[model samples]
Every structure is written in C-alpha cells, then in structure tokens.
Target chain A: MSVAIVFDREVAERWHLREVGVWMFLGTVVMLFAAFTSAYVVRKSGADWVPVHLPPLLWLNSVVLLASSLTLELGRRPGATARAASTAIAATCGLALLFFAGQVQAWSTLARTGVYLPTNPASSFFYILTGVHGAHLIVAFGFLAYLFVRTVRRTDVAGWPYLAGLVSTVWHFLTAVWIYLLLMLRLA
Target chain B: MSHSDSFIRKYIFSTDHKIIGIQYILTGLAMALVGGTLAGLIRLQLGWPGLQWPLLGKLMPVGMPSGVMTPEFYMALVTMHGTIMVFFFMSFVLVSGFGNYVVPLQIGARDMAFPLLNMLSYWIGLLGAIVILLSFFVQGGAAAAGWTAYPPLSAVASAMPGSALGQTLWLLAMALFIASFTMSGLNIVATVLSLRAPGMSMMRMPLTVWSYFISAIMGLLAFPPLTAAAIMLLFDRHFDTSFFLPSGLIVAGKLLPNHGGSPLLWQHLFWFLGHPEVYVLILPALGIALDMLPVFSRKPVFGYRLSVYCLMIVAVLSMIVWGHHMFVSGMSPFSGEYFSISTMLITVPMTIIGVNMLGSLWGARITLATPMLFALGIIALFGVGGFGGLFLGNATADMQLHDTYFVVGHFHLMIGGVTLLGTFAGIYYWFPKMFGRQMSEALGKAHFWLTFLPFFTVFFMQHFVGLQGAPRRYYAFTTYEYLNRTHGQNVVISLVAFLLMAGQLVFALNFIWSLVAGRASERNPWHATTLEWETSSPPPHGNFVEIPTVHRWAYEYSVAGEALDYTPQTVPARQVAVTA
Candidate 1:
C-alpha cells in the first residue's frame, strides 16, 4: 500500500492571521494618539495656555527610533543569513534601549527646566504624548527581546521569520507615529 | 482528547472558545442582575419621591440615608446602571458572548484564530467587572456623574461625592474593559478573515458571522478614542493636569485650579466612540434577527447582498453621525447640521434592512417556533424604536427633547428593547445546540409577550411625558410645579417596569429547567442550512469530528425537488444527484 504525506503549512501563510491582528492593534494606537493630539490642539487655542519649549533630547530620541526601524527592516530581508539576522536583531534592540534612555533624558531635562506636568497646557501634552508613546514602546521592546533571544538560540527558524515580520511592522509604524507627533508638537 | 482533560482545564481555565463564551454569558447574566436591581431602585425613587426603602436603607446606609434614597445615590444608580448594562450586559453578553460562541461554529471553524487571546479576553473582562462592582463599596460611593461621566463634574472631587475614589476606579475598570474588548475584536476579525472552512467563501458565510465580523471591525476602530478620553480624564482627576477642566471652575464654593481645557473636548472624544458604540450594541441584534428570520420563513434572506452592503453603510454612517448627540450641547450650528444630515441618512439603509426582513416573510411557509416568535417580536419592537430614533435624530426636535424623558424613552427603546428581544431570540434559537436539550416552547412564548408588552408600556409613554417638559435625571418631581403632573405617568411607568422585571423570571426558570430536564436535541432540530447544525448537539471541543466541506450558501431553504425543504451547506452534490 502507498501512503501520501503532507508537509506543514508555511510560516507566511500562518503569519497572515497574526499580521491581521497586529495591524488592527496598530490602527487603534494611531487613533489613540490622534485623539490626544487633537485635544492638545483644542486646548492650546483656549486662554490660560502656556507654551513650553520641548527638550532637545527628543530630536536624538527620534534618530534612535528611526535607526531601530532600519535595523528591523534589515533583519526581515529574505536572503539574510542566520548570523546576519541575529546581528541585525541585536542592533535593533540596542537602538530601542537607546531610544528609551533618550526619552527619559528629555523628560528629566523638562523637569530640570521647571516645565512640570501641571505647569502649562503645552507641558501636559508633552508629558502625555511622550509618556503614552513610551508605554507602547515598552511593549514593543518586550516583543523584540523575545525575537532577539529566539534568533540567538536559532529556535524554530521557520516561525521566527513571521515573528520578525510582525515586530518589524510594529517598530516601523511606531517610528512613523513618533515623527508625526514630533512635527505636530513643533508646528501645531 | 477533550474528555481526558482535567476538570479545571475543561471548565475553569479552558482555552476552548465555547467554554470561554459560556463564561462571558454567565458573567454577563450575573451583572445583569446587579444592573436590573439598580434600575428597580431608580424606578422606585422616581415613582414615589422621598419615600424611604425600609430594607434597602439598612443594607446600603451610605447611599440611602435614614431609609430615604438620597439624590447622590440616585445619580450613582443611574451611572452604574448605564455603565453596567451597556458595557457588561448588552455589549459583553450580546456582542462578545454570542460572537465568540456562535461565529466560529456557524462559519465552519473549530475555534477562533487566537484561542489563547480569546481566553485572556474573557478573564480581563471579568476582572474589569469585578473592579467596577468593587467601586460601589468605596468611601465616596459609586460613580455618580452619569454614565457619560462628563468631566467638570467627574474631574473635581468636590463636584460630587462619588467623584473622589469611585470615579477613578470607574475609569480604571473602563480601561481594562476596553483592553479586553480590543483584544476580542482583533480575534473575531482575524478568525473570520482567515479561518473559514473549505468552500465557505465570504458570500457563503451566514449573516450572523458577517455581522460579528463587521461589528468587530467597528469596535477595533471605535474603542481606542474612549480609552484615550478615559486616560485624559484620569489625568485631569489626579495628576493636576487640565485635559477636560476649564478655567475658573467653581465646585462647592471653591475655584478649581485647573486651566486651559475645554469641556467640549471630552464631549467630542466621547461621542466619537459613543455613536459607533450604539451600532456595536445593535448590529449583533440585527444580525441575530436577520439570521433567524430566514430560517423560520423557509426562504433565502431577502436581498442577501443588499443586507451586507447596508450593514457596511450603516457602520460608516454610524461614525459620522455621532455629532448628532452634541447638537444641543453647544457644538457649532454648522457641524450640528452636518451631523443631523448624516444621522438622517442612516435611515435609508435602515429602511432597506427593514424592508428586506419583511420581504423575506412574504408568502413563505413560516414556522412559529419560539425563536421565530421572538424574531417577529424584534421586528415590531425595533420598528417602534427606529421611528422614535427619527424624532430624536432631527436637530430641531432634539433641541426640545434633549434632556427630557423623550430622550430617555428613545434611547431605551432603541438600545434596550432591541437588544433584549434579540438576546431572547438567540437564547431560544441556540438553546438546543448550546445545551443539547430543547427549551419548552410554551414558557418561551409566555416570557416573550409579558416582556414585550411591559417594555413598550413603560418606555413608549415616556415620550409624551417628556413632551410635557419633564426633565430627566431629576431625583424628584415634587420640587418643580410644572413637573408635578408627570408623577402619575411616572407611577405607571415604574409599575410596568417592575412587571417587565417579573416577566424575566419566566425566562430564568425556563432556561434553568430546560438546561437539565428538557428533551434531548437532535443534531439539527431547526432544519437549518448552516454548518453549526452539521455538528453534534453541544458540539465537542474541536467542534467537528471531521471538518465539513460546504457546497452551497447558508440559506438554502425550500429548494425545488429536494427531499427536504432545507439543504444544509455541508450536503454534497452527489447526494442530490442520487435523490433526483
């Protein structure tokens, strides 16, 4: 008697399901920040509003985030070898940590300059928008760390690509959101 | 494999979608009891103003002082009642519970796409409910600034007694609830998009699954703004930030230190989510009615494609029409007009949906089963409620009806009536499949009539009472000379409301009795053409022993030359050829 065998489904096909879930989550995050920014704009137009200069470290933090996005893109490339992918992931995690440090420095700078949370409308928006974004990045970092550890151990390489793809998408979207927030704060 | 699992794994912490759905339903039922009790208290206060509740005063001494219901407590009852009913009972029970349990089965899938996430969503939702319930025991009492919790009242602690710790806990609870809902919404969308069984294409899927899918998408898009608003309000309450607090606000003879905030900002953010949230509550009910209508009428759903298109249109229109809620709240006239136009536009698709439902029943061999009667009941109730909505939707009329009993009447009829009837219909239709036992039809019909009459009697008259200029949210009518005439009507409404509550006892009795002692259900008791019927009664954990392949649409009823009136989606073409 002859028997037929079927191989397991590919990672991309399965990842499509996970990808849909992740994108929907990102969509909500975008709306959340949009709501915050719009409220900030409305409040700024009112009386008793005091505008404050944001700390310079925010620009450096933006650079770190952009760099993290680039490294994740490099890791997700199709032809990248295992060692190359691990190196890219390590770089991504390092840049993400650096971005968090920069954000903390910016907050400290604002605090030192007497721009406290309740001092003015501008400062409140500053703390709130960055704090909310930082919270989201904390979750992203946890996912990235998982991806990094998995890549280093070479565990389930077939599934690893899909996880990498999801992490990359989230990182890039957050990077774009940060850039948007920065410009909005600067110009609006 | 399911049978061998430990008891705890099978019942308590199981990742089975069906068990989690049951958990959602049971939790929602428990919350409904609490919510319903709150409503009873509210009606009691309204019916006999200044009358003391002898027993309740001792039990809730903090809220009811000296046997009389205090104004603050009455407000808390209103707030908690709306919050629990909308979030815990209506949305959680009808939308999430049914969507989780029935969507996967009806669409021929074993389970949700992310089963673990589905499990987590239920637990988080339960945690949120527990937190909200706990808020009532706090020092300041439960949240009292209305369910909307508009912030000037909610922001300052001195504004209301319940604004202190209770509002904070309320916000925290809502945040957790939003998280749970967001996760489940993602699960539903992903599952429907990616996990359909073979040959069950988008068009072939049941209307129930489609409505769940569309509502999930709406939830995903709508809930985040509410979360954002909650966080901003939390900051306003505690961190001395001024998100919703305006300048020079005086509460209890003290000027609030907050500045540079717009109260309208909260209104905008809230209604943005609020309008779509109503659709989120009703679409599942509409879906239930649409699905049941076809099965009972023994006909293909009238304008199947049109119904789908209409749902999408309603969803899109629901988003833009939220501004209608703010027309009399001091929003710009132009913007209010825009909202009024958009709000009226929704009736076009709504009318189409109504026509299609009525058309399906024309000249059809109807089965007046328990589920069908409830479905017909929904049509009548929803028709009345939808027309009441038109009166409130018009900006000109809304100016007069804004804060009156008319608004309350319109809202309760539209949301409360439709969801209640639709939920009963679903419970009846799915009872056999859910428990492997049939509910008694006689008790079901009695429950429906009793509930239907009292619900309409209580709410429909409120419109006329409101036109008399009786304001809502008032603790007593004796204070205002003009409102004193409304007392008699209020007495009648309250009496009818109590009767409605009593009628639900029949449903409880019938459900409990049928679950244990009713007749055993066959595999397909309703002669339905859906995949869920192809599975065993109270389907196994995997849902199907062998996955069935679909050959036709879900509503294949009364086909010519067939042995039976219905042809299930799972039937193969070869069987029909041999029969012919």
Candidate 2:
C-alpha cells in the first residue's frame, strides 16, 4: 500500500488551500452562533417569558474576556521575543482564569437570587447557553496554554502562530457571545 | 505525496483514503446489520400482531408484551431504524466511504486536503453512532417521537413515553453527529476544490467528485440548523427552557409550566436541514450512476454540464421545499401552495438528469455487467419514484395522501431505491479498483435482480394500499376495517420484504467471497479514463506512483482513430498515436 511519489514544494506552496479551508470552517462556527443568537432574540420577545435579572459578576467576566483577547492579539506581534510572547500569553491565561472564576460567581449570584436551573425556563437558558459557551472557551484556553508552554520552550514561532491565531479567533467569538447574552438579559 | 510506509502506518490508523474507506464500509456494514435486525423485528411484529417472540419479548418488554408491539415501541423502532440507516449506513457508506476512497484517486491527488482532520471526522462519527445506539439501553427505551424528533412530543418528558434519558441521549448523539458531519463536509469540499491534478479543471473532474462536493456544501449549510435544533431540544429537555415548548401545553391534564415557544419553529429549523439531508443521502448514488453509465456504455456522458447543473438545482430546490412536510401540521393554506409549487418544480431538474442518463446510453456499446445492471436499475427506479413525487407534490393530492403508506412507498422508492442500488453500483464498479479483484458477475447480477424486483413489489404495493386509505407507522392492522381489506396485500408485501432482505445476503456473500477468491483485476479493468485507474489496483497509500497530469476529459471513450474503445488516463499522448 506504499507508493513512491514526490510532491513539489513549490506547487504545494503556490496554493495554500488549507488556509481557505480553515477560514470556511471557522465561518461555519460563526454562522452557528449567529443563528442561535437570532433565535434568542425572537424567543425573548414572546409573552409569558419571565426575564431574569442579570448577574452583576457577568460584567466583570466580560471585561476579563475582552482583556484576554487583547493579550492574545499582542502575543502575535512580529518583534515579540519568546519571553515577551510568553508574558502576553500568561496575561491571556490569567484573564481566562479570572473569567471562569467570574462565571462561577455569577452562577452563585443567580442561586442566591432564587433562580435555580429548574426553577424557571429563563434561569435554565441562562445557565445552559453561558455554561456551554464557557465550556468551549475553556477548551480554547487549554489550546492557548499549550501554545504558551511551547512558546516559552522556544519553539518556532511560525508553526505556533496559526494555532495562536485560531485560538484568538475563538476567544474573540466567545467574548462577543457573552456580550450578546448580556444584552439579551438586560433587554429581557 | 510519496511515502514509505511501515505496516502500522500503512494499515492500522492509516491516513490512506482506501484504508479509511474500507474502515467506513465495514463499520457501516455492522450498523446496517443492527438496523436490519431491528427492521426484521418490526416487520415480524407487524405481520403477527400479538404473537410472542421469545428474545424480542425479553429485549423490548414494554414495547413487546408477549410479542405484541406497543405504539411507543413501534415509534422507537421506526425512529432508530431510520436514523441508523440514513446517517449511519447510507450516508456513511456512500459519501464518507466512497467519497474518501475515490475522490482523491479519481482526481489524482495524493490524499484528502487535511488527512488528520479526515481521520478525526470518521472517529467522531463513529462515536456519535455509538452514543445513538447507547440510547436503546437507557431506561424508557429509545426516543419514540419519530426520527424527526418533533418537539412538544420530543421536548416534554411527560408527553411521550420515551422522552426521558433516551431522548436526552438522542439529542446528545445528534449534536455529536452534526459535529462529525461538519468536519467531514469541510474535508470533502476542500479536497475536491484544491487537490485536483494539473489540467483537471472543475469541469474536467469526474461527476462523482462534483456530486460529493455539492453534497458537502449542502451538508455544511443545512446541518447547523439541525445542530441548533438539537441544542435547543436539549435545553428544553434538561434545562426546562421553552424553546420548542409552548405555554398551556397540557399533558396528562397538567399544564406544562412553559411558555412562548413554537414547536413549528423547531419543525422549520429541522426540515431546513432535513430536506437537503435527503439529497445528501442520495446525491452520491446519483453521482455513482452517472460515473458508471458512461464507462459501461462505452460513451461519454451526454450533457455532462447539464447533469452537474441538475444536481446543483436539486440541491438548491431541496432547501426550500421542506415546508411540504408540514402541510398537514396546520400550516397556512397559502404556504402549502407555495411549498407544493416549489416541490413540483424540482421535477424539472430530475427529468433533465434522467434524460441525460438516457442520452448517455443512446447508440452506445452497452455492457450489461453487474454494475451496469444496478445503474440501469437506478435509472428505472428513479423514474418510478420521481413520478410518484407528482402525486405528493400537488397540495390537494398531498392532502389526501399525507401520512399514508403512499408517502412511505414514494420515499422508499426514491431514497431507498436510489441509495441502495446506486451504492451497490459504485461498490461493484469500483470493487476492482478498491480490492484488486473482480466480483462474481453471476452472483452480483443475481443479487441485483432479486433485490430490485422485491423492492418494487413491496413499495409499489404500498402505494396502492396507501391510496386505499392505509396510514403509515401503525404496528397493527388487524382491527381497522379499511386496512383489513389490505391484509392480503400486506402479506404479499411482507413476503417480498423477506425476499429483499434475503437478496442482501447474496450481495454480502459475493462481496466477501470476491475479496478472497475472485479473479484478480487488471491495472485498468474497465479501460476508464479516470486517473483512479491509472494506479495499481488496491491503490497505494499515497494513491499514485506519479500524480497523473490530466490532458483530456474523463470520458474520452471510443474517440476517433483509437485502436481500443477506451484508453487509460495514464497513457501518454505520444504512446496513444503510436499504439493506434
């Protein structure tokens, strides 16, 4: 089942179709979240839906997420040394940690407000949507942490940047989703 | 593209498309066994309404009381069987299996666009299949709200009997399945677009790749809606959200404490994904038939562009006509008319495809090989099935035939007929390329005709019975007087079903036997112009020794002054003139 064939590096380099493929894949994910958010708006406008109050901790979490996105963007700068990249990566990691902690605090705030998951549909959606989005962000953070370790160990920056860029895109997406969730809560 | 492979790298967890295709085929075969066994039990229960079957009674105690099938259990079987056959068997085997194996080889690429992602996609789909099967073991049995999993029934645990842990697992499995499809669709689209050999333009690529590429696009666009629907359903079930559950939804005299959700919204979302899904299930088969017809007929495809455009037209039209499924669900009469017109208009593309196929076969040296037999059978069955669409596509006719065995017959003829027959055509046509051995033509033809005749008998009779007022999804017909008139017809249909089931055994036997004892195939058995046949049979890990530089179209059979009717794609232009 083996063949002796050689690929021309020049030919392979001429068409970086993998980049286009990755973009398409990422675009699909964006559209999925977009559809979900649209449904959120339509469903929220209906009567008999009791809109729960937003947890104050979510505001802090949103700021933390925004800061994490900034740190990730800075880490990708051209002249950043290994140490400088790691420093920015560490900031992203720290902010992500704070964001997770803030999410937990927000859940507790809802609990203290007598808005348990099973108590009402509104609380349930609040927990489920945010919880799912947070879980995805956690996975993104794990990828970033891996990149941070590799960068600190002086791995080639070229190889790591694409992965870092993907993680940053997902992180930015999550930050936007959180803002949308907050708006939905406030309007409700 | 070239690689020296160790045994482990070549076979086990191999990145090779051929190996991956075999893995998918074997997995699909296993799932088909499970799905077919379930169908057998369902048919048995239907045939004998209350007869006690020993193992079945033990396995499905709630659904089968001393072998008597309950409605909930019937629904569960229907749902699981449809889910397994469609997603696990048909789509998996046709698109993932054949598409993975052939698309790159046919277009002279070394491998898929992203090999690692392709591997992950298959494993994720395998995991999803496992999760779906696991739902059966859970308490309250598998989801019984139909494969459509329409909400209110699917959303409320108290509404349907199987809406407990089983429903939860069903949603989880579906979400995972959508993720798997998304990954696979990305790979297919990327591979076809970026990996074609030099001189192989988009139009020059084989129709099989085109069909797969279009199907992947449709899946990418459509599956996310279903994923959203699944997530929303999950929230409704576990999180007590009213996404698909409306207020004042009373069940068992208790009003569900939910509000502001429209179940119709779920239907719209589900069918937006669902209708294109039918094409996703069938397009590969259509592509297979198109590829096979020219080879077996010793002619180029007639109106190749027209055929490709027909597939695109069908793909686009399939997205809009899903509302026809909701005609009887209390949609506005005007909406029904709109859906009906769009649905009927799809026939134009289908008719164009049929005419192109016939034109390809016109005045050509036809080889009635087993593969050609199956391809011809598809053309005939697709015609029969397409005509039946006219009955259901008319709003007034659909009003009379909706939810009846007529709809069942129509789909079985369309989906099952095209998918199964077309897939077999692909398997038989490509067997030599995939396995390096020719299948027994006698056994293959036997399998084809036997399967084909019984399929028509069973489904064709169903249309008549449906027109006589027999509804679908019923476990028993012993009591309904109108249905009682059709008992004899049911018996005959059951016999045909039994024969159809048995015919598959011949195919399995032929397929298995060929791998071990059949005649070894030539390097280019069919003298096909496709780049796939340029390589050795059972194509190497990297697919080709030297990636083929395509100089002509795929269908250059019987060109003027050619000594042979066909020429292999790898034949150099200089050699061809000398040989001729």
Candidate 3:
C-alpha cells in the first residue's frame, strides 16, 4: 500500500494535487505579507515615522536569490546527468544559505549605523518584515535541505523530481515575495 | 490507517483523517468544559455580586482572593471564555473536526491532499491549547483585555494583572493557533478542490462539502492579518516598540517611554480576521443545517444552486464587513457609512439562505429526528441572531448598542446558539457513522428541549437589558443604580444558563453510552442521498473499497417516477445504464 497521507489510489493520476497544494499555500504567504505591507503603510503615515536606509548588502542578497532560482532551472534542464543535477541543486541550496547570511549581515550593518528595532516605527517594521520572511525561509530551507540530501543519497531519486518541483515553486515564490517586500519598503 | 501499522502508528501518530478528526472533536469537548466553567464564574460575579464560594478561593487563589472574584479576574474570565469558546472549541469541533471527517469521505476521496500536514495541524493546535491553559497557572491570570485583545490594555503589561505574562502567552497561543489553522485549512481546501472522485462535479458535491470548502478558504484568507497583528502585539508587549501603544501620559503616575502608535490599527487588523472568524464557525453551522434539511424533510433541497451562491456571497461579504465592527472605534463617518452599507448587504444573502431552508421544510414530511430537531433549531435561532445584526450593523444604532448587553446578546445567539445547535446536530447525525451505533432518541430529544429552552431565555433576556442600556464587560451590574432592574434579569439569565449547561450532560452521557451500548444501526440510517451515506457506517482506511463515481447532485429525493425515494450519488443514470 502507498503512504496514507501522500498517496491516493486513483485521484493522483487525474490531477497534480501537489502543485495545487503548493499554489494554495502560496495564497496564504501572499496574504501574510500583504498584511505586513498594509501595516507598514498605516504606521508610516503616523508621526515619529523615521525611515531608515537599508544596508547595501540587501541588493547583493537579492541578486543571490535571483541566482539561486536560475541554478534551480539549470538543474532541471533536459539530459542533465544524475551527478550534475545533484551538484546544481547543492549549489542552489548553498546560494540560498548565503543569501540568508547576507540578510543577517544587512541587519548588523543597520545596527552599526544606529538603527535598531525599537528606534523608530520604520525601523521596527523593517526588522519585523525581514524577521518574518526569514522564519518562513527557514522552514523552506528545511524542505530544500531534504531534497538536497535525497538527491545526494538517491534513495528516493525516483520521486525526487516531483518533490523537487514543489519545493522549487515555494523557493521561487518566496524569492518573489522578498523582492516585493524589498520594493515596498524602498518605494511605498 | 493500514492494517500492518502498529497501535502507536495507527492511533497516536496516525495520519488518518478520521483519527485526526476525532482528536479535534475530543479536544474541543475538553476545552468546552473549561470555557463553560469560565462562563459560570462570569455569571456568578455578575448575577449575585459578592457571593463567595470558599471552594473558588481554593481553586484559584489569585483570581478569587478569599472567595471574592476581583474585577480583573472577571475580565480575565470574560476574555478567556470568549477566546476559548470561539477559537479553540468551535473551530476545533465544527470547522476542523467535521471538515476533516466528512470532506474526504463525502467527496469520495481516500484522504486529505496532505494528511501529514493534517496531523501536524492537530498536534500544533493541541500545543497551543496547552499554552493558553497554562496561562491560568502563571503569575498573572489569563488575558483580561477581552478576547479581541484591543491593544493599549493588551499591549501595556502593567495595565492589569492578566495583562502581564498572561497576555503575552495569549498572543503566543494565538500565533500557534493561527499557524495550525493555516495548515489545516489549506489541507481542507486542497482536498475539496483536487481530490474529489471522478464524475463528482463541483455542483454535484453536497452543501456540507460546499460550506466546509468555503469556510476553509475564508479562514485561509482571513487569519493572516490577525497573524500580522499578533506579531506586532507581541513586539509591542515584549520589545516596547509601541506598535499598538501610543505615547501615554500616566500609568501609576509614571510616564511611559513608548512613542506614537495607533490602537485603532490593531482594531482594524484584529477585526479583519475576527469578523470572518465568526463566519468561520457560523457558515459551517449554516451548511450543516442546509445539507440536513434535505435529509429530514425528505424533499429535494429548495434552491440548491442559490444556497451555494449565498454561501459564496457571504464568504466575500464577510471579508469586507470587518470594518463594521470598528464603527465605534472613531472611524470617519464616511468610512463608517461604507462599512455599514456593506455589512447590511450580507443580510440579503443570509436572508435568502434562511428563506431557502424554510421553503425546503414547507409542507414536507419532516423527520423530527434528533439531528433534524437541532438543525431546525439552528434556523430559528439564526433568524433571531440575524435580526439583531440589523440593529448593530448600523453605525448610528451601534453607538448606543456597542458594548451593551444587546451586542453580547446578538453574538451569543448567532455564534453561541448556532454553534451549539450545529455541534449537536452534527454529532447526532454522524454518531452512527463515526462510532457505528445510534444515540438514544429520548435522551437526544430531552437534550434538545433542555438546551434550546434555556438558550432562548438566557440570551433573549440580554436584548431586553441591552435596550435598557445595560453595558457588558462589567464586573457587576448590581453596583450601578440605573442597572438595578438589569441585575434581576441577570439572575434569571444566570439560573437558566445553569440549566443550559446541565442540559449538555445528556449529550455527554449519550455520546459515551452510545459509543459502547447504543442501538446498532445500519450504514445508511438516515436514508439520505449524500455520498457519505453510500459508505459503511464506519468507513474504513482510505474510505472506500473502490472509488465511487458520482452520477448526480447529492439531493435527489422523492423523484417523480423513481423506484426509491432517494438515490445515492454513486448510482448511475437510468438512461446511461440502459445504453450501456
């Protein structure tokens, strides 16, 4: 018998349940950040709202995230050997981690420049949105790490492509959400 | 769920939707007792002020010092009661529990799209319940700033005793609940959307499935804003960021260090989820009633498409009506008018749904089964609750009625009454399916009358006292000279409330007794035409031996020239069968 949670006898053949599930999950992530955006706009309109210049490292991290998505696409290109596919995915995960390290670096850079969380409303929102997005990335990282290890071990390589697609969607979606939050802070 | 799985794997770490569903229902039952005791404490303080029970002092020494319930303690009880009843209890049983057990089976699927996530949702939710309950044992009492947790009081720790550690724990617990609800709701939505059996078109699915589908989607859309609010509130309380706490003059004659913050922003964020959160409970109750109306009335559901449309419309309207709750929060007159008009517009679809049910029951051979009785009761009580909304929906009218017993009364009927009736109806209706035994009809009928009568008296009296200007959230109304008559009504409401609680014992004992020794029933006891009835009394692992193909909509009762009164969705069309 197949897994109780993961498999159905007949329905899985008819539709991409995993893709649909990922799409629905993205809807919620969108709402969560949408709320943060609204709160930012609302709080920014108030007095004592001092906007802080974000650290320059964030631009580099954005490029790193964009690169990670690219390497993910590269890994899935046709005729890639098993070893090559594994190596590409490993590179993508490494870049994703580097991107997070860059985020922490940006926070420290802000702190060194005399901008703390409770220093002002804009600073507070800046810390919050970044912190929340990091928390979600941590969860995504865990899943992606599973995929990385699976490709290395190749125990579930047969189904790893399917799993890889789902995780990739989340990874790319978060990358887009980060860009949205980044731009909202910068422009809005 | 597999036969080869061990007891620990099959039952404890089970990913089976049925087991997870029972976990939700049973946890909700336990929390209901806790919530009910809190209510009893509230009524004791309000009904007969200063009445001391030494046992109470022994039970909770901090909240009730020397048998006297403190004002802060009363506030905590009120907050915890509302929080527990609405979020913990109702959402668990009706929304997650019923949705989990019924959605997969009724839609003719093996299990939820993500059953592992379903299990995770239940466990995380249980953790949240434990965290909230643990707040009572902390240095301060539970959250006192109302379940809404409107900021300034909720944000500032030293505002009250419960405001200290308890409120922080409340936010943490709420964050946990929202996370769990997010996962569970997504699972429900995905299952409904993607996992239906072949030939089970969206319209062919039962209203029970439709209601739950809409409720899950609505919850998924609505909860995140509150998540955003909770995150900020936690920051405000712990980090002193002043997200919801404005620059204040004095707290104990000392100036606070917080800067500019808008408490109204918290209201907007909280109610964005809070308004739909009410519908999250109620729309399912309405759905439960809508589906059952066909079963008991033995008639094709009146306006099946319209009922589904009404649910969809309500879901959309429920999102926008969050502002109606902020009418008295110093909103601009123009914004208030906009919110008010949109809020009233919900009643149009709601009224249509009600009329559809009444029309379904008109001149039909109604069963008057225990489930039917509770289902009918939900319809009547909902009408009363909806009528009260008309008064509160208007900004000018709510100016007098906001925070009054009238507002309290309206919600109690709509949320409290409807959920209570819906829970029982669902339990009775599905008991045979869940446990494979029928509950006692005599006890069920007795339970209905006992609960229904007092439910009417207790809440209905609030509307009267509210009209007379008796405010809510007070420690005791007896202290006010103008509220002297209101105190008398309070006592009556209290006494009847005791009866209403006592009435639930019948259901409890009936549930327990029926589980082991109630009358044995067949697979389809109701003779209903839903897909769930087509399976075994207790459906097995993966729900069906073979995936059943749906042929028609769920409600095909008393057809013009059919051999049977009802036809299961699995049955093929006569024309198709003949051609084959």
Most DockQ-accurate candidate: 1
> Which 10-residue span in candidate 1 chain B carries the lowest summed lDDT?
B571-580
Residue pairs of candidate 1 with colliding backbone atoms = none
* Cα lDDT tens digits for candidate 3, B1-580: 4456889888888899998998899999999999999998898888889988899999888888899999989999999999999989999999999989989999999999898999999999999999999999898788899999997889888888899999999998998899899888999888988889998989888888999999999999999889988999989888979688788636767777888988989999999999999888998898899989989988878888999999999999999988888778888999999999999999999999999999889989998999999999999899999999999999999998998999999999999999989998999999899989999999999999999989988999999999999998988887678989887788888998999989989989999999989999899999988778788878888888888988888888877667777878778896333111
Tens digits of per-residue lDDT, candidate 2, B1-580, equal 4568788876667777788777777888788888887777767766666777878778767788775677788888988988888888887888788888888898889888888777777778888899989998888889888788888879988777788778888888887778777887888888888888987888887888889999988888888777777878887877777888887889978988777787888888888888889899788888889888989999888888888999999999998899888888898899999999999899999899889989999999999999899999999889999899898988889899998999999998988889989888988988999989999999999999898999988888899999999888887888778688887888778778888899999999999999999899998887788888888998877888887887666777887787888766566676563222
Show where candidate 2 strays beyond 4 Å. Answer: A1-18, A55-63, A116-124, A173-188, B1-12, B52-63, B158-161, B249-255, B570-580
Candidates' chain B TM-scores in the order shown: 0.98, 0.96, 0.98
DockQ of all candidates, in order? 0.74, 0.41, 0.73
Q: What lDDT does each candidate get? A: 0.87, 0.82, 0.88
Q: Please tell me what DockQ candidate 2 reaches.
A: 0.41
Model 1 TM-score relative to the real fold: 0.97
Each candidate's iRMS in angstroms? 1.0, 2.2, 0.8
**Hey, what RMSD does candidate 2 come out at?**
4.4
Reference-based lDDT, residue B569, model 2: 59
> Can you list the residue pairs that collide in candidate 3?
none
Model 1 regions more than 4 Å off: A1-10, B1-3, B573-580
Question: Which tens-of-lDDT digit does each residue in B1-580 have in candidate 1?
Answer: 2556889988888888888888888899889999999999999999998987879889989888788999999999999999999999887888888988899898888899899998899999999999999999998899999989998878887788899899988998898899999988999999999989998899888888888898889998888888888888888888889888888888899888998688889999998998899888888888899989889988888888899999999999998888788778887788878988998999999889888889889998898898898888778877888898897888988998888998888888878888888888988998888899999999999998889899988889998889999898998889989888999999999999999999989999999999989989998999898998999989998899877898888888877787788889888876653221
Question: What lDDT score is found at residue A71 in candidate 3?
Answer: 86
Could you estimate the TM-score for every candidate?
Answer: 0.97, 0.91, 0.96
Chain A TM-score for predicted structure 1: 0.92
